[model samples]
Target: MRFIIDVLLTGLAIFLAALILPDSAVSIAGFGWAILAGLIIGFVNATIGTVLRFFTFPLNLLTLGLISFIITVLMVQLTSYFMGSKFDVANFWWAAVFAIIVALIELLLNSIFGSKDRD
Candidate 1:
């Protein structure tokens, strides 16, 4: 189904991001762990991320949307925490870098393979 495809694509993006970064920056156990990490990332982003964004909307406006990016980086850190050693991010800057990489890769993959309805 579409949801499964999205999850797989996200997983691929996460795995690719890990491979693209230095070992100390970001690392995942393997593709399988990446998939689970992707799922957790989605959940966290959907639940806690949403609330945080809503509350920080004022800061987001004042910062010209910079706060949104910070929220995303935090989401990555939270995902790493949930994934334990399976998915590791070294520090705030590294998490920010990892988030950017994952977003870029996910955008590319979704544009190529995502369902037509999404477009």
Candidate 2:
């Protein structure tokens, strides 16, 4: 299903974020928690992220892609909040680094999987 594909992509993204960010840590409970975190993250992005993006359209236009990095940080923070876990980044810089790494990993996976559209 589409939902499952999206969750998988999100989990991969989170896993990559954990790997790239030195301060971030992920528990090894199992795939279930990762999938749950991914679902929560996707839901937050779909709902809260969309509204935030719409409200910040002008800022986004002015700052170009820089706003995207901020958005990613916010999304990361949101994920942490929803999952009731901590993503301890050194600072915004580390968060930015982690976000970029996650994005790249997710893009690679999506490409290999031919995207969620096929699900």
Candidate 3:
């Protein structure tokens, strides 16, 4: 049940990112690939992201929340790399924007479905 929810959330996030980032696209054949990519992304974020956030806590504090955006962009890029495709952004700025959009959509969905408290 949790896994299904996670996958759906990830797919939605990837879809939102696709919508917001001009260069990001998933082929129709890539839908399955995108879901797989999302699973790996979610796993990476849950594991490596947690570690990075922990180590960057002081920097995150100093930056007043900007660091989280950077971290998210990095994670998204990492996901693209791992998936063996180009999930392009115009630049860091666009990546940040896409990340923010995905985050917002995920937040709204999670809130509506009550999934935020699971972990």
Candidate 4:
């Protein structure tokens, strides 16, 4: 299904981001944990993330949509909190950066592989 594929892609993106970011930015026990955390992250993004974006529409407009990075940081931090030691993000800025990278990678992958949801 599309959801499962998204989870796997998210996991791969997170794993790749961990490699690019410094240890101080984000840390994971291993690939297994990263994949597990990725599923959680994806779920949070689908549920809470959607609501947050809707409610924060004003901020998004005021900030010219840059507030999205903050939303991503919150989502990533929430994933870290839920997963405990499996995932760790020491800095919110790092979470922001990680979120950006993950989003870009996922976007590229989705485009290259073809997405049914896209027109």
Give the alpha-carbon lDDT of every model.
Answer: 0.90, 0.67, 0.69, 0.83
What order do you get sorting by TM-score, best first? Answer: 1, 4, 2, 3
lDDT (Cα, tens digit) per residue for candidate 3, span 81-107: 665543444456665676677778888
Q: Put down candidate 4 lDDT per residue, 1-119, tens digits, no spaces.
A: 77777767778878888888898778888877878988888788889988999999999999998876688689999999888877998878888888888888878888887784853
Per-residue lDDT tens digits for candidate 1, residues 55-88, read 9999999999899899888988999988889999
Backbone clashes in model 3, listed as residue pairs: none
Runs off by more than 4 Å, candidate 4? 116-119
TM-scores, in order shown?
A: 0.93, 0.75, 0.74, 0.84
Query: What is the alpha-carbon lDDT of model 4 when measured against the actual structure?
Result: 0.83
Pick by TM-score: 2 or 3, better one: 2
Off by over 4 Å in 3: 24-29, 86-90
Among all candidates shown, the one with the greatest lDDT: 1
Q: Write the per-residue lDDT of candidate 2 for residues 42-119, one digit (tens) a residue.
A: 677788888888888899999995775687677766676655643344456665666677778888888887776674
lDDT of 2: 0.67
Residue 43 shift from truth in candidate 2, angstroms: 1.6
Worst 10 residues of 2 by lDDT: 21-30
Question: Which is superior by TM-score, 1 or 4?
Answer: 1
Candidate 1 C-alpha error for residue 88, in Å: 0.4
